[model samples]
Target: MLRIHFTDADLASTRMARAPDALWEVAASLHRFQTRAGRWAYAGWYRTTHARLREQRLDRIVREVLLPLFPRARYFPDFLTPDQSSCADEGLDAALDAIVSTPSGRVGRELALLHGYVRVPAWVRRLTGRQERRDLVAAIRSYHEVAVRPFADQIHARLEAGRSSSCRELLDGGVQGMLAGLGPGMRWQHPVLQVRYPVDRDLHLGGRGIRLVPSYFCWGSPVSLADPGLPPVLIYPLLHEPIAAAPASPLTALLGRTRTTVLRVAASGAGATTGEIARAVGISPSSVSKHTGVLRGAGLLISSRHGGNVLHTLTPAGASMLRTDT
Candidate 1:
């Protein structure tokens, strides 16, 4: 378990990431390749990513180079997932630049830590070399283009939904409620936030605060930087609803005013709960449920239960249809 001790000041300063952290997503996505623990949730991505890697001829590089460096084990180099504050924005280019510019000493030290956990190839030491770092960055960019970028719309939609949920929690119950609502793996006890983790450790945030990053690829327990001295960040998985296998109805079939309003609500930055949707559309909650059922059947919305309420967000197909209609 990871216990994050927070001072009153830390609580005041804590904030959620407005966008996905590009490098952290890369690390977490690489981890997906290492385990089948949550394979059902990522089955579509797994199959397509495998084919993409083979088609791009990056299969060997990923297996021999990336996997060894980022084993889903106790430690990996922190330098690889640079603090987003150092980048101009959360774009992959900015992140790649940060990785390329990582100080050689820091890279060497972190790699040494990784070496202790898994066999580090002698050539991996060359990452400290400027040209080699650039080469590695190039490879990482290619991998992202093929494996991660294709799902950008889905990722953005999920992050937006998550942020909306967190914002509501914050408004209704303040930071404590937001923290407590951070899915099943985390518990917000006063003065400290306890997280299920692979190892036991304590992090005392001395008023530097922490950034709560919601990641699409991250699964199971949340991840934190190994070195606590760095700016504190907690990267946690976004809740993924299982994709329904029902055949989708055409967009033309979903043009009713009420259904259109429902689609818009799901697309909104502040995603709607079933009760909220019923209120918005001036319909009964049971009527709203039937509407959401049709939307889910058409692959236009995904509903997941949070606490006692069910939250709805647009699937990529749903968002696309909303966009085309508008």
Candidate 2:
């Protein structure tokens, strides 16, 4: 069993040295979901949507990653099915055609794991709070040690056989190989994908993964803790929906005037406090909360507290609305 130790210095370096300048943001976003109610809601919401882009991401990643072995794939889904119910039947139908015409379950299983990993139901978000996270950490850590290490070995072997010679080279090459193959639908740019093991990691459920894989292929999918290399594993890159959310109601459309105000306040590169937002939007703190609540319910705004102040920010959706309006 291996343990990945982190010194305060090491963590600080990692935080400062995050690649793509985006990991910091992702880490913060995830931190927000660690709260009590936040985690519960996230756990419930992620399951409903993780497959939104799996079809699309898988189509691309699978075709690219395994295409060298098989080339008959065509008509792959343009987007993965995070929540099959959320997708249009037209795209879903085309996906089936491509799926049926494609090769058998072996390759399908590997690629499909990513989709299943993404569909982990935001269980990590369910930790009661710091105490639960601490209580669960030991089990999770053990699983990570035993489960992910084997997959890392497999990945390393694949990398060495696939390319360059050093340990760093192997890590980089393997990660690049996997990420490169993530396709257009990969939601997160720098997902922490790997195999994990958890004591309760489901055995009977679909793709009871012990492997830990993360990607921004779908920003909506929550971060999960599991080892994917173990039994009942699923393969396939599942990306989130393309995020082309359009509110049918005029009030819902164009970020609504109320939402627009809240988002604008949050934009100045600094998140807005409820008090600040209320003053900016000319409403009571309660009213500011009402509007923000609407935006949050829509997944367009996210709230956090910095020091003594509660802060609000336009999520990707809210940011997009502001940008699109301009």
Candidate 3:
């Protein structure tokens, strides 16, 4: 077992071990870090939430913690030399996912600050309103001349239980297999993907029962922003029911195209029929129905049938969207 302690007001790392208790403890500490960072991110970006922050935080931990610990004289001396890729490849997206997927706290915090800090230089450089991009990458080399690595038991346990076959499996299982593979004489095939050091000299090992792979957060590529192939970055909405009922406007992007039509159709005061709305908006009756459906979806309007004719009236959302001198 391993233990690291912290207070409510701060997040810091104080312990290390190559055992189950220790690795998981590191995980918990990192999770707290992620939670705290998430709060900051939420406050910084009004529309963001905790879940999204958690992923980024975890990524940072791997970017910083795991990479720094493996080399020195104290651990992993036996595994480096001949084989490389025994470690994680170095990149923001790769590092973040590697740690957070552990679903641990301590590791999460360490990772967030680590990645965030490294990214700072580049981010700062890119933001001066000057057109530019930043670059931050380092090579993955074995922390040779060392022995023993973090999470010895956790890694061994996973290997013993099976799950150590490929790089993808290890990444998918996360800490479970990575720790398991953290023996001696083993290295990673993808250095850019995560940390690689010699666990031993003969082979790549560890990885068993890993499940929670962290989501990808790449600031470099515009195409990656909404890529489904990227691990899912969930942002749990904090609202309990609609906050003050969506500001009395249900739609997020209907301002330019539909605003005028909406106002003209609803101007009769008593509201308008579907045909009347189509005439007013200069669109087909079916199109009016579609717009009405959207408005209704937004909690902005309501529709009712009077015999063969249907009437549409403004709800609070609709009225808010339709503002005139009267």
Best by lDDT: 1
Candidate 2 vs candidate 3: the lDDT winner is: 2
- Give the alpha carbon lDDT tens digit for every residue of 1-326 in model 3: 11111122111111111212222222222332333333432232222322443444534534453334221221211111111111233222333233223233433343344444343223322222212111111212111101112223322322222222223345665433443343322222332112222221111112111121111110111110112222211111111111111233533334434544554455432566776566544577787888788778878788889688777777866676655312
Which model, 1 or 2, shows the larger TM-score? 1
* Per-residue lDDT of 33 in model 1: 94
Q: Candidate 2 lDDT, tens digit per residue, 148-250?
A: 3223322222222212112233256543343334333222222232222222232222322222222222133222213323222112212322122235534
Single out the weakest 10-residue window by summed lDDT for candidate 1.
243-252
Per-model TM-score on C-alpha atoms:
0.78, 0.24, 0.22
Q: Highest TM-score: which candidate?
A: 1
Candidate 1: Cα lDDT at 104: 93
lDDT of each: 0.84, 0.36, 0.33
Q: Which stretches of candidate 1 lie over 4 Å from their true place?
A: 85-90, 246-326
Writing each residue's lDDT as its tens digit, candidate 1 over 119-193 gives 878999999988998999888888888888887756766786788889889999999899998997999999899
User: Which of the predicted structures, 1 or 3, would earn the higher TM-score when compared with the native?
Assistant: 1
